[model samples]
Target: MVAIPQRTKGIEVTRADDATTTEDFRRQRIAEAAQRARAEAEARRAAADAGNPPRPREINGRDGPEPVRYGDWEVGGLATDF
Candidate 1:
């Protein structure tokens, strides 16, 4: 006759321990990802506000150079909204 082994208390304890470890690891990974995302956002913001002078770029293939728009369009050196 085939015999089936009965579940032991030690097995349950080990399983519980593993579950706790997995949860902790998951939380740590999530926190790290959030931190990285925040850092990337800050870097993007800094680059955008780097104070570099705007250069004129052609808009819609217009014949003349269109002002390099930063925030608002500069028409005759005066800031105007589109």
Candidate 2:
């Protein structure tokens, strides 16, 4: 009986650090955006509480200016039929 030791040649094992970095970057970017949105909303609410409100800019998707709504306001604006 003869014993032979064999090794695999030219088989490359790679660590995909690039993929990990890309996914991590995307996650961090999304988290940053969410945090910024939350901060902005909090600031706006505080301003409203102080009797100073903000208005939307004309650059938005709407064709014209929209009233800044606060505290249980309806999206359909003021309702009629009183």
Candidate 3:
């Protein structure tokens, strides 16, 4: 029987004619091509967003002063009784 040779992970490999099927190799190639296409599309989107400025939001409610809280809790102590 004839033998087929394939290189994987920097190693030389050899398999018999029936050992590896054409469908297995085709699936691997299709998956790799899909990954490359997705990566390229993402790069294009990032470049476009960087060039555009951020838009401002509209406020429909009345504006008022907001309350601020500072350090009201004690440190290294629990409020719950055992």
Candidate 4:
């Protein structure tokens, strides 16, 4: 009669049988996500810079301040020059 061995935790498992291809799949997924993020950022930057410069706001009878746009974000009334 033959006895079968029981499997236990912390025991080393060997993959000397069928070949596994898990590592290749994981790397492909990470690369795809990075590419998508880069494309989106590029599009936002183009849109922000395409339009005419924003007009400056008029303060108490003085020339208005110009608003600054940075990649889909905007800041108004800034004293520092861009």
lDDT of 3 by residue, 1-82 (tens): 4566766643445665533555567678889999999999999999999998886653663233321234324334643211
Q: Against the true structure, candidate 1 has what lDDT?
A: 0.62
lDDT score, candidate 4, position 65: 37
Which scores greater on lDDT, model 1 or model 2? 1
**Which ten-residue region of model 4 has the weakest summed lDDT?**
10-19
* Model 1 / residue 61 / CA error / Å: 32
Candidate 2 structure quality by residue, lDDT tens digits, 1-82 = 3434332232232334444655676788889999999999999988888895555555434332333432433346854221
Q: Give the residue spans of candidate 1 off by over 4 A.
A: 1-14, 51-82
Each model's lDDT comes to 0.62, 0.56, 0.59, 0.52
Top candidate, metric TM-score: 3
TM-score of 3: 0.46
Estimate, for each residue in 1-82, the C-alpha lDDT of model 1 and write its tens digit: 3444434432332454466766676788889999999999999988988867666774655333343543435656876543
Report how far off residue 75 is in candidate 1 (Å). 24
* Model 4 segments more than 4 A misplaced: 1-20, 52-82
lDDT (Cα, tens digit) per residue for candidate 4, span 1-82? 2444433342332442211333444567778998999999998888887875876765553233333433322336444434
Residue 72's lDDT within candidate 2 is 38
How many clashes in each candidate?
0, 0, 0, 4
